[model samples]
Every structure is written in structure tokens, then in C-alpha cells.
Target: MKLLKEMIHPELATRTGRILRRHAARGIVLREQDQILLLFTERYNDFSLPGGGIGEDEDMELALVRELEEETGARDIQVKAHWGYIEEYRPYWKPDYDLMHMTSHFFVCDIAPELAEVRMESYEVANGMRPVWVSIKAALDHNLQVMSRQEETMGLSIQRETFILEKISREIIF
Candidate 1:
């Protein structure tokens, strides 16, 4: 896929540079034992997959690994599939940019099955954030307030989820 600069709105190109200092980024959804791992975010008090902004000139997969480790204290990630992309929108509350949005590359991943040690970033999740393992069925609901907040930041409206479902559906089934 083309970089966001090549494909996005012209306005995004002009203002994004000055407004947002951070560059492209990626994230991951790690699954184990029919459940998915998620982190509660401090910024919005939302439940989201572990992720973060990509640094300058960083590769997408490398960014994914970095984010997963920083947010979830996870290591040795084994990616399963590319779950597609999300055009993340930074609402007015965000202070890091002149632009009001970002784009993210997302993937589905897996780690060790049993409960292994986790190292949560205390600063990132002092109270509003914590690692939670939820069943796939429960996680798919995406109805709670935290999830809604997560949806907003992650650009996870209905259409995005639908696309992700379509991408992963075949692999999930026989």
C-alpha cells in the first residue's frame, strides 16, 4: 500500500507535518486460548490493543513489536496475519499535533498460551489502564464505554471492524 502521504487528503500532507511530530505507527491484537489481550489506556480510560506511534523511518513490523512490548510488556510476538489498517483520528484533546489525525497498521498476533509474566508500563496505566484477557465473543461485542472510546482513537467504526472481520474470517474458519 502507498504511504498515507501518497493516498490521503492533500490537506493531510500540508498540515500533518507541522501539527503532528510523530510519524506512522502500528499495533497488534494478541490471541491466546480463545481470548484476546487488551490494555486499558490512561489517556481515555479505554480498553485497546497494545500499540503506539511509530518513530521516524521505522519499519511497520518493528514498530508493532516495539509497541506491543512497551504497552503490554510482551516479547517474542508471533504474527498470524495482517488485520488491515485503521485511519486513527486524534481528537481535539490530543496536544501533540497540528493535524488532528493519524493512520495505523494493525495485525493479529499470538504469544505463549498459559499465564506468563507481564510487565505493564506503570506510567501508561496507573489506574485507567490494565491488561485484561477477554473471550473472543465478549471482545467482539465492542459495546462498552471504554471500547467506544477505543473505537474513536483507533478509527474503529463499524466499517473498519467489518473489514477486519472479513480479512480474518477465512483464516479463523476451516
Candidate 2:
């Protein structure tokens, strides 16, 4: 996996803490028409790519497929390309978790029209995660809005997604 970008929270270096690393899988679902599939979460008032963490001993491609299906009801997806990966570091994102490091692997995928119902996780449902198809410009604009806010108040996950969206807009979307 190539490193597309590295993001470190402003305060991360200021704090003394133990760093923990986690791996996540994310996808940029682009239909033939060029619309992007994103997950809108009302809880955080943000849009994110339709994928999640890689399970232990799971293949990266398979993990992406499973996450897309679970989050967006996507089926028969064909991964077109690997968009590389990104790393993000945030200190004090959680009380129990002092320093958090995450590496996200991204893919460019195409989805089949015949889709099943979305099967979101309980927490996702509670957070109002819903699949939405929008133009790449719209997704980039929305993420920019989220990124423009104060980092102290913004959700860490949202901040990370904002970075990914911006990168996708620049590298993948025309």
C-alpha cells in the first residue's frame, strides 16, 4: 500500500502518550455515471466512504467488499483500482485511548445495480448512517465544510474522513 498522505493532529506532539495503531479499509464507490457512494451520518453531520476496519486474518479486498455490502447494500462490486492508503494520528481522541494511529486503505470500486437492503451495524444505525449517491463535487464540498470547523470540536472520525474525501477529490475526481 502506498502512502497518499500523513495527518497528525496539532496537539498530538504536545502530549505524552502511548501510540496505538489500527488498520481500516475504505472504498470510493464510483458508478459508471461517475456518482460516488458515501455514508451520511447525522450523528456527526458528515459524509464518509462506505467501508470500515479489516477483520483479523481477513483479506483486504474481501474486507472492503463486506464493509460496502454491510454499509451500503452494495452487491456485485468490481474493484477497479487501489487508491493507495493514508495515515492519521490523533492524540486524546478518546479517554481510554491516548494516542491513536490509523492507516486506511482505499479502493475504487463499481457497484451492481441490483442491491439488497442496507445492513448497518447497531451503532451505525444509531448514528444515522445511510447510503447516499452524490456527485464527487458535492461530497468534496460537504467534507470541506466539516474540515473547516474547529478541530477541538470536530469528531476525530469525521476529521479523518474529511482528509480522505479531500484526497479523493484531488486524486480521483476530476
Top lDDT prediction, candidate number: 2
Give me the runs in candidate 2 sitting further than 4 Å from their true place.
14-16, 32-34, 92-96, 149-153
Task: Give candidate 1 misplaced runs (Cα > 4 Å).
Answer: 1-18, 21-33, 42-45, 94-98, 114-122, 140-142, 145-174
Worst 10 residues of 2 by lDDT: 150-159
lDDT of each: 0.53, 0.80
What digit string (tens of lDDT, one per residue) describes model 2 on residues 1-174?
688888787777643467677788888876655578898888777788889889779998999999999999998988888879888887755567789788889998888876689999899999888999887777767767767874444566776677777776777766
Alpha carbon RMSD to native, model 1: 5.7
Task: Output the TM-score of candidate 1.
Answer: 0.60
Clashing pairs in 2: none
TM-score of 2: 0.87
